[model samples]
Target: MTAVLNAKTVNYYPANAGWTNMWTAFDPVRINTDLAKAAALGADTVRVIVFPQTFGYPTPSATYTARLAQFIGLADTNGLDVKLTLFDWWSNYTDIDNSVIWALSVLHPYVDDPRVITVELKNEISPGDATAMAWARQLIPAIRATLPAMPLTLTVDGTSGAPGLTSLKSQLATTPPDYYDFHFYGPSERSLAEIRRAQAAVAPAPLVIGETGLSTVSTSEGEQGAYLARVYRAAQVAGIGSVAPWTFNDFAAGAIPANSSVSTQPAQYKYGLHRTDGTAKFAATVVNGAWTSATTPNSILNLGFEAPTANSPWRQYLPQAGAAAITTDLPRTGLQSARFTGTTRTGSGLPSLLTSPITPVQAGQSWHAEAFARGAAATGITELALSWFDINGAWISQHTSNRLPTGTTTWTLLTVDAVAPAGAAGVQLHLKSGDNTGTVWFDDVALT
Candidate 1:
C-alpha cells in the first residue's frame, strides 16, 4: 500500500489578491513561507491549483509558465510533493482541441518530475454535463500518453459525493485514470460510511479524500478542530490512500473574485487553517496532532461564550434580511450577546435559533439547560427548547420549557429541565423566539 499521503491545499489568495492577480502579483516569499508551514505540520504533499484563464489558456505565456515552475521548485526545497490541479476556473467544453493543447502545454515541463506526485486533470468535473464528460474522457488518454509514468486523476466535487463519482465512473469506465480524488464535505460522523460508498463507486481504482473542512464562519474554532479530528481519524481507519484539507489559509475580506458565487457568502472566506493575519487556527493544531499520531486536545465547550476559542456555535434560521448577530449592546456577563430580531413568522415555526449543539447524552438521563434572555419591544412568547438528536446527528424531538415573560423584560432566566428520550445520543440548547414582532438577547447559556 502507498504511504498515506497527507497534504494541504495551498491555493490560498493573499490578503488583497485573488486568482486573477496570481502571476501579475506572484509573491514567492509568501508561497514559500506557507509551504514551510505545511511541512512543519508534517504533510508530505502540498496541493496547488492553476486556473486556465489565469495563465494564457491553450497558449501559456513564458512568465506564467515560469511562475508555476518556481512554485514547484519551492515545494521541492521544502521537501514536499505537489498535486497540481488544472482547469480551475474553466468551463468552455466545446473546444476539446483547445483543452488538449492547453493541458499538454501545462504538463510538458512536469512530465517526469518527481516532485509532481499527481496531476489532477480538472478541479471538479460535473457528471451530469455530457459535454464536460466528453471533454474529460478525451483529455485523460492524451495526458496519459505523454506522462505515462505520472499518476493522473480528477476529483468529483463534494456537492456530488458518492453519487457523482458513480455517475462519472459509469460514463468513463473504459478510459479511467490511475486513481480518483473524492472531495468529501459531509458531516464528521458520516465520514466513514460516506467514504465507503465513494470507494465502492469506483472499486478497482484507488480514492483519496482531496478536500474536507469546516469553516469558522458558522462554527467555532474549537468545533472546526473537532471536525478535522473526527474526519481524519475516520480516513485513517478506512485506510484511504490519501487525505488533504481544503484550504491552508483563509481569504481576507473581498479577497475572492467578485464574479464568483463564493464571494457572496461570508462563510467561504474563512475556510483556511490559517487566518489572514498568519496566525494558525485550532484546525491547524488538529492537523499537527493527526500527522504526528498525538492525541488532539479536547474541545472545551465554553458555554459562557467568553473564552478565546468560544466553543459554542450559534446559528439563526428563518432569519430576516439581517435578523441575527453577536453584539456588545447588553451582555449579561461577558463582552458579547446573541441578538435575534424578526417580524412575523410566515412558516409553521417561529424565527428561531439553535446553539451549543450536540453534547452527548444517555437515553433516560436527566438534563438541565438555562440561558439568560432579555426582550426589547417583545410580544407573543419566548420558550427555551432542549432539542434531541440521535447518534447520526439526526434530530429526533425537542422538549420546550414553560413560557417565559411575554412583554419587554430585563435579563430574564429561561430554563429547560427534561429527561433524554429513548434513542437520544445528543442534544442542542435551542432558543426559539416569538411568532410576532420583537427582539431577543441571549447570554450565559449552559447545558448540563
Candidate 2:
C-alpha cells in the first residue's frame, strides 16, 4: 500500500553453488541463517529466483517444491514476506500449453499463502522475442485469473533500459501484468533519472526497481556502498513503490558453474552486501542508509594496487597459460608492484594481468584508469586498457590506454579515461602486452 520501503533480493547461493545446482543442493540451515541476515539488513521483504533445471520444470518436483516452501517458511521466520522470481535461467518459449501447466503447478500451492507477496511471471522477459512474449501473454492472464488477489509483474533485462520496458508495455498492452519490474545496472549518478524513465515507460501502472546493486568487482567496498547508496537513495527520492537489491551475500570463489554464462564474470561473485563469511561489506552499512543515518561509506579493501605483497584482488589472466609474480623491482607508492611478462600469443589469446571487475556501469559513464609502468625492452603491443562487458557478461569492447613506455624507461604514470559504451554492465582495469617480449612492471593502478 505504502512505498515498498525495505526489500532485498535473496539471490541466494551457498558457497560453490549457483542456479544450476542450488535447488538440488538446497540447504535449509544455510538459508535460515542467510534470510536472518537479510532481516538484519532491514529488509521486510525478499525476492528469490526459481530455476527450471533444479526446480523440475513442466511438473514441479516435490523435493524442490518443498525446498521452495521451506525457503518461504524461513522468510516468514525472519519476519519477511517473499516475492518469487520464476523461470530464472530458463528460455523454453516453444511450449505455451505446458508453460501454463508449469506455471499453475508451481504457483497453485502459493495461491492463498500470506508469506508470498508477489510473483514475477518471468525474470527479464525478452521484448524482442515473439515466442517469449506469447508465453508471458498466455501465462500472465492465466495466473492472474487463477490468483486474482495477488500482484503479478514481469521485467525487461537491464541491457534494454527503459526503452525495453516501453516495448514490452506496447506489446502486452491488452493483457499486461499488475505492475512492471525494472532491473537497473546503470550509472549511479543517473539512478533517479533511470527510474523516472522506467516509470514513464510503464505509466498508469505501478513500477518497482526490482533489482539494483553495485558489484565490488571494479571498485572498492566503499565505492560499492557509495554507488549502491546512490541507487537506493534515488529510488526513495523517486517514490518507487519497491526496491529489491540484486543479492544478500557474495559468492565464494569457484562457487558458480564453469559452464554457466556468468562463470567468467568476476562481478557475479561480488554483488552481495555481505561476504561469503557472513561479514558485511561497506555497502551493507548504507544499503538502507538512503533512508537512515548510516550513509557514510567505509572501505576496508585495497582499491589501489598498494597491498603489501602484490596480491589483494589482483590476479593474472590465465596463470597456467600466463605469466606473473610480485616484484619490488619498481614500487610506485607501496612496497610492491605486479610484474607481467608479455606472451607470444596475440589478439583474443593475448595474455596479461587484470584487476578484479568493477560493475553496474551504463553507457557514457566516465571510467578513468591509471597505472605506473616501465618496460624491459618490451617488444610488440604492450599496453594498459579498460575492458568492458555487457549485462550478460559478454565482452563488448575494449579501449586501450597509452601503451606502456617501451624500451627500458622509468615508471611513467599511464592514464586514460574511457566512456562506457552502450549496454555495458561491467568494466575491469587491464594491464596487457600482446605478443610482447621481455617484461613490463606495473604498480599503483586505479580505476573509477
Candidate 3:
C-alpha cells in the first residue's frame, strides 16, 4: 500500500477528559460534537487514537469494535477521514504477540473502508524500546499480509530534530511503513526546514506532521494565529502530505489528573484552537483561513457564517441611540446566518454595517462581495459595502452596492464589485443596513 491522507487535517484532541478518560466510558455525544467542531474548522481529516487496553488487547471486544465503527461513521458524516492510531500510550514491551493479535483483530473490520485513511501501529514509540520495535517489525508484516492495501504509518517523536528521524529509520528498517509520521512543536521556519530534510531522507515514503502547535504560555493568541498561518503556508510550499495540529479544544481545569504525565505541562492544556467553553481562539481563524486558501484558493474566511461562534472575525455594529442585535438564525445555506434587528437611528449610527477584517488586495484589482439577504417589515435599505486600506493601515475609501429595498422578505442575492485603489493594501467587506426600523437577515456572504 500507499500512503493516503485527506488534503486538510487536524488532530482530534478532545478538550474534555482527553486521552486518559476517553475509553473509561465512551461518550458518543462528546465525540460527535468534537468532530463537528473539527468540520467547522475546515478540516477534512482527523487523527484519532484507539488504546489497546480499551479494545481488549489480544482479542478486540465487540463493544469496542462497534463504538469504533460508529465513531468513524460520525466522522464520515462530517466529511472527515480518520487516521486511527492504535495502542496509544501503551508500553508493554513484552506483549509483542498480543500486540500483533491486537493489530490483526482491530484492523480487519476497516480493511475495505475508504474512510480509514491510515492505520498507525503506535503513537510516538520510543527508540529505546527495542522490544516495542521488534513487536512492530513483526506486527507490520502480519497486518500487511492480512490487509495488503491498508495505508500504514509509524509516528516517531521528532523532538530531538533530525537525529530522531535518523534513529527512527534505523529502528524500523525491518518493517518500514508507507508513511513517516512525526511531531514538531517549534518555530515554523525550523519545522519547515526539518520537514524538507526528513522528506529527502525518507524518500518514497510520504511525511505527515502528526502534531504541531503553539501554546498560550509564551505566545499571545494573536501570535498563535500568525504562527499557524506561517506554518500552514510553509507546509503548503514544502508539499507535506498533511499537518495535524496538537488539538481542537483546550482542556478544562481538573480535566486531567494532577499526577498524569502531561499534567506538568500547563502549555499542553492551552493548545486547543477553542477554549473549554467552546469559544474559538484567534488560531481558529488562521487555521480556517489557511485551509480555505489552500483548498478553495479563493474563498474568504467565515463567509457563510457556517462557523457560528462568538470569536468569529465578523463584527456586528449596533446603533448608538437605538436597539440592535445580531444573531444566527434562518440561514440561507449551512447551519447559521447573520441576522440584524433593531429600530433605526439617525445621525452617525443611522445605518449599521457588519464588517470583515482587512483582507489583502492588490491595487487596480477587481473584487466582488455577494450575499443572500431577507428582510421583514424593514423600512430601511440593506446593502453590501467594501472598504479599502493602504499598506500603512490607513483607510483609503469605501464603496457600497447590492441594496435590498424595505419589505423584501424573500432570500435575495446581493452583489457588489469594486476596484482596489492605487495604494491599496487590503479590502474590508461588510453587510450594511440603512436606517430602518425592522429586521434584516444575511447569509452565504462571500468575497472573491
Candidate 4:
C-alpha cells in the first residue's frame, strides 16, 4: 500500500503578512515573494489560511477562485506545495451547509492537482463548542463526499496534552481525519515528549506539528535561531510527518487589522524568520543549515572557522578581561584556527569561544567531541567543553574535557565523551581558557 503521508519532507507556515490581513490584501507580489523565501529555506510545503467570509459565503465568487488559482500557480513555480486551510477566523455552527459549499467551490478545481497536498477543514474550532463539533462532523463527510481523493484533517487549538485534544479525540471517533494535526508553543524537550504521546494517543493517523515558534519579544535573535534548530532537530529525530513554523516575515505595524485577535499583541508580529524590511533573521540560517545537513550526511558548514563571509555562523564569547580572534599562524588542520590571548581574569565563569549551534541528539545518546589545541607560555588551564540547550535556548548542562596543561608548545588533542540529558535540544562545542594569563590556539574540531 502507498504511504498515507510523506515523512521525508519539511513543511512551513508562511505568513508574509499577518493572518488577518493576508487574504484581504491578496497582493500577488507579496505572496510570491514569501513563497520564494520559503522555498529557499528548504520548505517543500507551505500551509496557507483562507477565510470563508472573504471568499464569499454559501459559494465563493469566481474572482476569489481565480485569485486562489493564481496563488497556487505561484507556489508551484517556486517549487513549493500548498496545504490550503479552509474556514479560518469564522464561527457560525448553524451555517454548516455554507461551509460545505465553500469547501467544494475552492477544493473541486484542485482535486487532481498534485501541488495541493492536503486540506484542513477548519482552523481551530473551540473544543467546548459541541455545536461547532457537530457541524464539523456533518461538514467533514460532506467535503469528503465531494473530494473523495483529497486528504482531509483538522487542527486542534492547544498542545497535545491540552483538554482541546481530548475533545478532538472524542470527535474524531465519528469524524475521522487522515492525519492528526496539532499546534505546539513551548520548550523543545516538552514538545518532543508531547509529540510522542500524541502519536501514541492518535494511533494509526499520522501526526504533524502544524504550528510552532518563538516570538522575538520572548527571546533574542540568536536564541530564536537556536530554539528553531533545537525543535526542528527533535521533530526530525522523532520522525514526525511534518513541521510548519509560525511565519516567514514579521508583519509591519500597519499590516494587521486594528480589531483582529493578534492586533494588540506585538509579539505575534515578530515571529517571522525575516524582519519586515526583508532582512533575514538568524533563524533563517539555522533552518537552511539544518536542511543542508539532512540532505548531505556529515556536512558541517564552516567546520574549520575558514569562512570569511559576513554573518558567519561561528561566534565568540568572552568575559570583560578576555579576548579572542581568528588567526592564521600555527594552524592545526586548516589555514586558520581560533586564537585566544588574554591575561586578566574576571573569575566569573569559564571564558571560551563557541561554534554555531548543532542539531541535538536524543537523551542518553552517546556522542564524542574532539579538538586540537596549543598553549604559548600560558599560566592557566585550557580545556574543551560541550554545552546543551533546551528548545527555548536555555542552557541545560555542560561537560568539559580534560584540561591541557599551559605552556604546551606542541599541539595536543582534547576529547570528551558525553550523553545528552533528558531535555537537550541543541549542542555547542566550546574551547575554554581558565581564569589566568594564557594564549590558546584551537582548531580541527569535530563532533559525532
**Distance from true location, Cα of 243 in model 1, Å:** 2.4
The numbered model that scores best in TM-score is 4
Runs in model 1 deviating more than 4 A are 1-11, 297-448
Worst 10 residues of 1 by lDDT: 1-10
218-261, model 2: which lDDT tens digit per residue?
Answer: 76676566567666656666777466667777888767777787
Report the C-alpha lDDT of model 1 over 162-249, residue by residue, as the tens digit: 8899998888887887788888787764466577778899998888888888888877787777667666766776777466876778
RMSD of 4: 5.0
Number of backbone collisions per candidate: 0, 6, 0, 0
Q: Write candidate 4's Cα lDDT for 228-319 as tens digits.
A: 66567667767874666677777777677777867799898888778888888877777676655543122233557675533334555654
- Full ranking by TM-score: 4, 1, 2, 3
TM-score of each: 0.71, 0.66, 0.64, 0.73
Error of 4 at 348 (Å): 9.2
374-405, model 3: which lDDT tens digit per residue?
A: 99888767888787766445678988875787
Better of 3 and 4 by TM-score: 4
**Structure candidate 4, residue pairs in collision:** none
> In model 3, which residue pairs have backbone atoms overlapping below 3 Å?
none
Per-residue error at 363 for model 3, in Å? 30
For candidate 3, the lDDT comes to 0.72
Alpha-carbon deviation at 185 in model 1, angstroms? 2.2
